[model samples]
Target: MNENRRWSTRENDRVLDEIAKRQQNLRKTIQLNRKEESDSVCLHDKLMSEI
Candidate 1:
């Protein structure tokens, strides 16, 4: 029974770690997209100013 409990705890920890990793990746992707969008807007404004 103790061994089973230990296995269960390890499995839970592994699942939690996977979830954390996915969340981190999602945050990074969002930040990157936002940065790209801001850069594009700036470029557009700069071009418009020149014209």
Candidate 2:
């Protein structure tokens, strides 16, 4: 029974680690998207100024 409990705890820790990794990836993706959007806006303004 103790071994089973330890196995379950390890499994839970793995699941939590996976969740943390996914969340970190999600944050990075969001930040990248925001940067892309801001860059596009800057480009649009620059083009308009040239015209």
Candidate 3:
């Protein structure tokens, strides 16, 4: 019974770790998308100015 409890705890830790990794990746992706969006906006403004 003790062994089973230990296994369950390990499983929970593993799941939590996976969730943390996914969250980190999602944050990185969001940051990159925002940067790209801003860059495009800057480019658009530049083009408009030229015209």
How much lDDT does each candidate structure score? 0.68, 0.68, 0.68
TM-score attained by model 1? 0.57
Candidate 3 residue lDDT tens string, 5-51: 99988987886676567656656667758776566557556754764
Q: Per-residue CA lDDT of candidate 2, range 1-51, in tens?
A: 999999988987886676567656656666758776566557556754764
TM-score of each: 0.57, 0.58, 0.57
lDDT of 3 at 48: 48
**Candidate 2 Cα outliers beyond 4 Å, as residue runs:** 32-51
Off by over 4 Å in 1: 32-51
Quote the lDDT for 9 in model 3: 89
Q: For model 1, give the 10-residue run with minimal summed lDDT.
A: 39-48
Model 3: residues with Cα > 4 Å off, grouped in runs: 32-51
**How many residue pairs clash (N, CA or C atoms closer than 3 angstroms) in each of the candidate models, in the order given?**
0, 0, 0
Give me the overall lDDT of model 2.
0.68
RMSD in Å for all candidates: 17.0, 17.1, 16.9
Superposition-based RMSD of candidate 3 using all C-alpha atoms, in angstroms: 16.9
